[model samples]
Target: MVPFRSRVRCGASSLNMLKIAGAVVVLAGAAVFSQQVQAQAFPSHPIRMVVAYAPGGATDIVGRMLAQEMSADLGQTVVLENRAGGGTLVGTDSVRRSPADGYTLLFGTNAFVITPLLHDKPTYDPVKDFQPVSLTTVQSLGILVTPKLNLRTVQDLIAYAKANPGKVNFASSGNGSAQHLAGEAFRTAAKIEMVHVPYKGTGPAMTDLLAGRVDVMFSSLVGNTEHVNEGRLNLVATTGAKRNPATPNVPTVAESGLPGYEAGTWQAVLAPAGTPAPVVERLNAAIAKAAKSPRIVETLAAQGMEVRTSSPDALRDMLKKDSGEYQVLLKHTKTTLQ
Candidate 1:
């Protein structure tokens, strides 16, 4: 048996250990509680949303609209910052390097998934570097041809392209833009060869297309609506799987001739990877609410955008799926950035 003094020391040591353990538990619980509180009170400050394109563009316009509505829903200001360059690489890399505190977000587009595939070396990984918050909208592209081309439908365009081969040229917003990808997809699906004429932006590309400098273009419906309505541009087929509500008379590429041929632009909100789950959830909820707002819905509809929101997981899955699809499409089309 131990002596009384030894027994007392052992008891005290055990008691001290218990106290330390208890304190550790309490501290850990406090830390967790503090984190919970912080997450709950997220956006305690203004959030900066990075638009990966220049101002006065579709992404910027849609991002601003969504930011305004989300600010109201989140009870905090969401500022827009344009960091356009490298085909959205500059802004995307900026967001990738930002703190995952939910204060910085990226207004990502289909380019987010396609740009990396176009480049031989990319600065960031879309799926790994960013946490998807929500998908904002999907904008369909109209297959516009110069009326002088006499391409009445997608079939007519395909037949003419097959007959003409490399003689048929299509204009795109840029070399690796969604417009370019859509044209490439069309080329692959239709099994035809067409020259790709890349311009600085949609304005220039549309100008060339309207001037009959280019025979065809896969352009945003919003941008070509007026031209199509005025008969300056012919709407051969839309790039969406279904007819756009704004132009129900226009059939989709799938409905026209090429089945499973759907290509269009999309915009989604994403936070840097490693953002807190609660913060992501909060932002997603705000986005969902904003997407459902009557004014937002109406405004997006007017711009030829269909408002569509998805959960974080859904958005992540979408990015992965789209990335894979783009890889295959790019490979098949042999599309490389110049």
Candidate 2:
């Protein structure tokens, strides 16, 4: 038989444990309720989207357009702010540290994964720190040749590069950029040797290409469409499975010579990780609606971008797929950023 004093002490401890368990259950319920309430009341104020690119650039322009569309859909002001620097690390890392609320978002691109993969020690983990809302744009790059080259098709460029070996120069906005990687991919597929000329941005690189300083470039047609229309630059081949609607006459690099070859950059919206599921769902639906808006569709289409909105899960999968593909290219090409 236990002593009466000891029995009393054990009974009291049991009671306290039960009390603590009851309190824990109550607190958990309260947390769930609070989260639901918060998610329901999301977007009660204006939202901010951080664009990790230079102001007045192609990404900025498209972000502004989508922001307006999202505003219409969410019935709240969606503001786009440019926060460019450190190869887009500055803006992106800031977003990762932001609250996991729907109010602040990151205008993410392929660089989101590619940039971190390039660094020896990444500041943040994209997959672990961010929640993808939706994929908004998928633009295929176009191959532009300077008028001095007189390269009419992908074949012509390949033939010339093969004959001249290391004489043909390919211009890119920067090292490890979509343009640079695409050029590397082309080099691999075509089995040709060409010198790579990397510039700080597309503006200067395109300037050089136009002045006959560089022979060719694999870039987008967003701001360069006018140059192509005016015959200042020769748009030879587009890097997509299908010809871009903006340049239907131009053939894809795959069809021209290298089959099963496609390379381009993409843009999407991402929230900080740990955001509420309901809030993520709401944002995804709104983005889908906004990207399909007639004005947004027309504007991006004219610039050679395809409006390809995707669900949150799909976007996550795309991030993984693109990461693998770009990793392969980086290894094969041995590209180093300056």
Candidate 3:
């Protein structure tokens, strides 16, 4: 038999535990209610979209366009901030640390996933750290070579690379970018040896490629079509299963000699995890609406980007799919990066 005083103390202790549990439940309910209220009051101020690349790169160009359109639709200014470096890690990771409000967002590409996988200690987990808003667009990459190389066709480039071996140099936006993997795929498929030169971003890499400082780059044709028109860059092939409408004359890399070779990347918007569900829905709706706009569709089409908007869940599935695909590519090519 327990003492009467001991029983009383145990009863009081149980009562205190119940009080603590009740307080926790109340706090959780309050948090959920606050999120709902915040979502209702969202866009009361300017929202910022961080582009993880240089100003002139495809990601930045497309990001600015989407921001402009989404701003008009959301009745709030969507400011773009470029934070490029470490193969897109610097800017992308910065957004991961931002508050879980919809005010701060990330305009990211496939590189967003690939960049983290390259590091031994990844800065963030794509699945755990972000809430994907929606995919903005998709585009095929161009296998561009400097005209100074005098390479007019994929075959010519292959022959030159085979003959020159390690003397052939390939450039990419950064160490683990889609461009980097595409170049590696080309080298493997063509059975050639080419040194990789990585830049801080595609803009800097394009600058060097234009000046003949680099021999080749697998890049977007967004803002560089005039260079090819003026004979400054030779776009020998594209990396798409089908011919890109923007450059129908350019054959796919598979048709150019490397059979069964295809690679491309998509662009999407993401917010830090724990963003309000209502805010995510609002963002997805704006993206879907903007993607259907005639001006936005035409402009993206001109740049070779297919205007393909998706739900947040669809975008999340894409993230997982690309993560698996890139993992295979990285392993097959034996690609490593710091």
Candidate 4:
């Protein structure tokens, strides 16, 4: 029952309200766009690469190498922070719960994927919680026994372990570590019975192995290559499929009468979910360059690691494949969290 002029005026006011709302929305969107653009200029400040190991471990070594090279490539300081505990769960969980701004990253190892399978309540889901940046390397495992063991080769160790059964004990870097998984895989494949003694870190594990507190340990050659060459430890077998050029005389587990046996460790870079795609690609490219550098390649080779420059998509697929296989292995191994 309003007048025609009043109706027209009301309609005009409603149209103005709509226009104001639209303008506000556009302004808010612009603000967000500007913020995102600012974020895309990543590494504006120092970037932290969290390594889940002590300073002297292979993980820390690789992390430092990447950090030094990445800092140069990104034109910012890239620092390594050691978070050694909970079988790498501590540092990995830190990255998982951190902001997704691409500044905080994780230098995750094979244990990162295998930890959840070995534990009852894993803090993060490998596939769901983070995005794979790039695969850094395939780190071969070395099965080293104490000099006092008097075992000449892997076959001898397996036969000895089988003959002795539960009396033989092997040491691992920690519970739910790749070292632990490697030892378990060997036990299952060789059908040998051995008790696993878990240490807080690889340093302690290697210490005990040297003191004969433990019989044997499957460790990365990065920290033990010198000792092996010095004859302080006996090299039984390597977990790689072929002989590593670094240790040309060493035989593979497959070659040591355990056909179809292959287990190894690896490392990759990951960022929290929700990081920008462009930034992820940039980071991937930087890592690819760093990992492929001749200096890094030669250094890693000496440590018995092979460089693998996988794309983000490729790394994503690798995660899926590895996670599926780990699930099967976990079920078969009957590995349960305590």
Candidate 5:
């Protein structure tokens, strides 16, 4: 026995609520559909891969190699952009600011983890600002000494370093480079003091090391292989967990004397944070495929690089682990950027 007016108002209210609910449901479904479409139709354009080093450098070479293969797999051009400076901070920041639409990616290295620890206040947060797509390569560093030094083994070098103390000099590509960290790690593990000399790049550092301007250097195995082969520079030991296949005669630092000592460089691809998960997965698959390609495997092997691709989650975990380890190394070495 309700009044006619009340009945009419209640009917209108119920109808309006039902209409609003229906609209919301439609909008939600549309949003999900839009995301699916976006994910399915991704990579409709070219991708820019930012390399955080100068052209002709190891990072640049590796990046270009991967880019060529990934370009084929993704059916899109993957362009290489070299943005060198700030110990890889410049290029990394550029990628960090880029849109999270999968068009821009950072071709990063172990320097990404080391440089931040060197700085008192890093410009970017390594863990929070980017999404790891894949790891490309891992190359060990060779402990190269001038033939004049006549250091034949890791123990010999450590003994000489201990006896010489501050007289021994170690050259690196830059202040906070991976090579620099490796040198520092060596200094710590060997419990010796050596003066650290920074250079513009590996080329310049290798030049000085060869010219006897510096007594020793923790150089890239690939970059200095010719010198090692020609006997121009003495390979004391390799800074890897095991001996390098290219130079099986050389012993690792761990085997030589310092157990549990391992230092090396690695490269990986990362996109800005907030990139779609589907797009990240797609990129990872392409990278994994490229790493497994025969041409790529042969090329990297020739350069003394081992092709090592990993899942995104695995890469993230590695980054976390390495960052912590680098923190300890930097502290022990007393290395500070600013």
Candidate 6:
């Protein structure tokens, strides 16, 4: 009889100990969940956003707009660092080799996607080296000339270049840049010949174009608008699929005797591959929100850009398609960087 009672008491004590252990396990899980919550907050430190072009360019403009908005959204400082060189390769490579944390990011353009096509050996792979965050905006290109040139239309420029041949020099930011390719593509499509004068950067190129040292340039509509309006530069054909609302009367390249010819600038956000999917989603959400802001929309519209926000997957798809198209264009046209 004493043994039966003692055994029943021992069973109850064991059950109580099991409950205690389960409670401890629950507390431990709560601690883990709290830590995960902190981690998901993201951007715990200052983020370095790389702009792969010199300041004052279209890429820089978009990057600054996004960095400001992202800083506000993420509750951290977002710094825009310009690493301009090698047709944007220098900055892009820096981001590619950066740690996979969300602290480092790249704000790039169609030039980044098309640079590899012009080089014999690229330093980094576009699809493999980076993850897309969002597509920010698409900008149309305008053909601008110094006021001294007195050029009116694309036809006038073509006639002048055809007559002068190598005498007419056009300025480009750098070799293999979107401006460079746009200039070359226009010359090829229109069957005109113009000497390409590659500058270390667009600032110098624009300076030369404004000083009448260079005959013409294919510049993003953003940077050239004020100059055109100030009568410092002459407006010519725009290189877009259709006429842009900012300059509706300006004929598109395709409509201006070169049918099917289209070239324009675009901007996108990217992060180092292996960044957490949650972080990417957070960044994308912030970007899409900022793009819809009336201030941002009006600011970019004033600069001749259309705000086009897209999901990360959509941006990836656009980059992939553009990469293939650039490769084909390079091969068929025998384009190369010098």
**Candidate No. with top lDDT:** 3
lDDT of 6 by residue, 134-251 (tens): 9999887898887776778888888888777788878887777778888888888888787888765577788888889998998887667888888899988889898888898889
Cα-lDDT of candidate 3: 0.89
Tell me the lDDT of model 2 at 232.
96
lDDT of every model, 2 decimals: 0.85, 0.85, 0.89, 0.85, 0.85, 0.83
Worst 10 residues of 1 by lDDT: 52-61
TM-scores for candidates 1 onward, in order:
0.83, 0.88, 0.92, 0.89, 0.86, 0.87
Which candidate number would show the highest TM-score if scored against the true structure? Answer: 3
Off by over 4 Å in 4: 1-32
* lDDT, candidate 3, 74-103, per-residue tens: 999999999988888988888899998898
> Model 4: per-residue lDDT, tens digit, 41-135?
87689999998776777778788988898888899988999887887888889999999878899998877887777776657888889988999
Candidate 5 regions exceeding 4 Å error are 1-31, 199-201
Which ranges of candidate 6 are over 4 A from the true structure? 1-39
Better of 5 and 6 by TM-score: 6
**RMSDs, each prediction?**
3.6, 2.6, 2.3, 3.2, 3.2, 6.9
- Candidates sorted on TM-score, descending: 3, 4, 2, 6, 5, 1
Q: Candidate 3 at 96: error in angstroms?
A: 0.8
User: Which residues of candidate 3, in runs, are more than 4 Å off?
Assistant: 1-28
Query: What TM-score quantifies how close candidate 3 is to the native fold?
Result: 0.92
Candidate 1 local Cα displacement, residue 323, angstroms: 2.2
Residue 8, candidate 1: Cα error in Å is: 14
Candidate 4 residue-wise lDDT at 271: 94
Error of 4 at 235 (Å): 0.9
